[model samples]
Target: MKKHIFLFAIVCITQFIYSQNDNIPEKKTQKGFGKIDFLSIKMPETTIPNESNMGFTGIHYNLMMNDWSYAGLGIYGAVTGERGGFFTLGINAGIKKYFTNNFYLDTGFHFGGGGGKSAPDGGGAFILPHFNLGYNFKDLSINSGWSYVNFFDGGEIKGHQLNVGLEIPLDFSYADYDVAENDYSFDGLQKSNWNVNSKKSSLMLHLNNLEIKGDDTNKNVQNFGRATIRLAGFEIASYLSKNWFTFVKFDGAYDGIKAGYMDVFLGGGYHLPFNKNRTNILAKFGVGAGGGGGVDSQGGFLIYPDISIEQKIFDAFFISVNKGYVMSPNSHFYTSSYGLGLKYYVERNGIISDENSFSEGIFKGIEVITKQDLYFNAKRDGEPTEDMHQISVQINFDLNKNLYIAGQTSFANFGNAGAYAEGIVGLGMQTNPFINDKTSFFAQVLGGAAGGGDISTGEGFIVKPSAGFNYQLNNTLSLRTAAGYVKAKGGDLSSPFINLGIKYNLSFLKMN
Candidate 1:
């Protein structure tokens, strides 16, 4: 009996040793590192300071490595001089590859140029080849690069850039590793978790611009309006993480009336904490060239960065303060807009986990808004009109985080016997269903009501349904294409519209 008991103890000890060995992390002979890395570059600090001679200073980012690259499609403009200024607009694309540790080669191209009536008014393209050398020590990294810029018009600009930056791990590596080791932990011996409190930060230097877009319609005279404007020439900016960022933005818009050169703005602000999770908030106070158009008649250079807030009251309810200047060729104006927004999550987590569990859920939300124009004029063939006022409400709902429907109602009183009400409804679906994730399909159906007077006689309705698909090229940008049909009830009018646009995810602001 004693011999048998001793043998049992020896077998139990052997099984314990085997279990301990199984829990240890296996030593990988070739640990593959991430190919995509964020490299922060510093902007030029010294500026050729002169009120008339605009200078730029800020940080930029160059995201190119291992035969991979990125490009941005946007617009920019600036005003400089006493009586006349210049404007430039263009797009840029770049590529890069790393040959060894701390050594890489990069190439990029850009096209755009503008100036005053008598100044250099021309557009051209540029190609730049650069070299980068840097050391990445754990979370901190320092890098420097030199580039040779060649222009299509036989011009050349040589420059150098340097940057020192840090990256913080925003997730629990230990927890993640344990879960990964256990193959998603179906045995209940381990748990998978995410560190929601982790903060991701970055600082960079680069050239950038400010942009806005919208459309308006009035039923009194069967009139519709659409406008888009790009502000800021080539100016440097310092983007600090997702919470706080600042930029020294410039402006140059030339419509024959307010033609003058020299417009510069500089300022920054912090995110207002309104939501406990910090996913929603007010991004108030960015002092820079206020919105609006015309060379000299734009909003005052100082105190122009408008104030605004965005909040998610609940999963489906959203609110925002959409104020600021929307530049046009006629004059600089101010728009005060307050509205509620909504979002609904439908059918989330469609992919099955290793444990045969599928994580899925739904979300929905809404928003109401009213907007008024203050001290700004509408231009009818270069002439300014009285202040304009508009009020609108928008509603949105998601069925399974994949399918959604939206509706909007707006009332505009131009203060000229031109009061009208407009209503719109739409439906959309996503090919990929995930929160803040990308989708391949985004189809919609829309219908609207327009016309002045009582709802019976002078009432007109319009129906439009659109089908579109979006390919998220990356985390920050997406490429989309849409086509739709339009039909009217009161008027014998029908048409089709096709649009291809890019949408960018700006800093995720918070709400109170």
Candidate 2:
């Protein structure tokens, strides 16, 4: 695939850059979490429905316990021009045998799930057995291997890919490091850390789907919000303590009949830990407003219980998945939704710190971000893509170093097609991509109401989910580009967006 070639080229480019940094010392550590971004392609001679030329791009993270063992997880998006595309989230365990300081071989097995309309191969569920050799640079590496994929639909695919990515440091081999080598599993990192109270406070921002169940009010539901394909909103969770948490969740989905849907919840819950604290079960209940079909379709109450499983893949970074049934009994409403979220924990006892990263003082305090976007594929069926320009401002309320809530507002111009505007509030997480502290990785999903734009068909609510990196131009300003998906209510029109923006990080006062 063309994409794969582009990905391989990136590796060459990065290698060139890494070599120029020869003045820097070689970073050979025993234990660390390296966050790597990869792109690859597969060419299967035996053409299957969608296996001809497949290109995949995603972020991969590895928890290397030492030079000889590691665990890996990646969330990737794949596409085949002739066979559609899908989102694949996978995890693998492997061992590394270094023949020399810079050369090593790795072999592993991967298991994961795939879904979305793009995943035509029966949800794209599969397992992969693979092996490859890699050469490590000071902070970069290259690995190429062959992988055999076995799909649930009786489809088998054979392919090979090369991964070129930067490393994310998880250096527990430094000062005050107390974990015994025996304590850290050599089989690769555990799926999760499993300690609930170990960290006092936690913050999470996520994208979720609302699948309304029951056949009684299918039509009415359509009149209320998107019944299916709810590329909807986000939720912000503030885990106050190990067993207690609070939430601010927003939902903006389409109502088949009209531009409808807007809901916000403020609630809290209790958590219980089992399985030696490797997993947690939580119950959260919230009361919020679901106003859309005018002022009268407002003031709704929601009660839902979610039992979630949390596992640590590397350090404070973890993954959570849960299923919930929601109902506004008084409103005669019943719906069920499933969610997958990535969470980072900030402890209550002390400030979160990464000695391997840039000084914590480089980040923190009130921050503001502004961006301009050009949205494509904004029109409905049989129509050419539309170019819409939008500008927005966001105010980030700092709660701590690694976590915060971002509130944003935007104005969009669709030319004669119509105009649109929105106000968004959501949670966000930030981390440095390298030790320099000049480059940052930010991921967030924002939910808000979109009105006044392209109102000829009536105004609808909108939800946008995006991720991107930032390059600090200086201490106060940075440049960023983000990519996201935007879905609107009532109108089946949605588009993928690329945003270019600038940000200002200000330290108004000091924090102890």
lDDT of 1 by residue, 318-435 (tens): 3443445423233332222222223221111112222123222111222111122111232222223333222333333443445665554433223221222334566677565244
User: How much is the lDDT of residue 246 in candidate 2?
Assistant: 75
Write down the TM-score of every candidate.
Answer: 0.37, 0.39
Q: lDDT for model 2, please.
A: 0.52
TM-score of 2: 0.39
lDDT tens per residue, model 2, 341-419: 7665543212232211211111125566767666775653333445665556676756565566776655442322222
Per-model lDDT:
0.34, 0.52
At residue 4, give the lDDT of candidate 1.
100
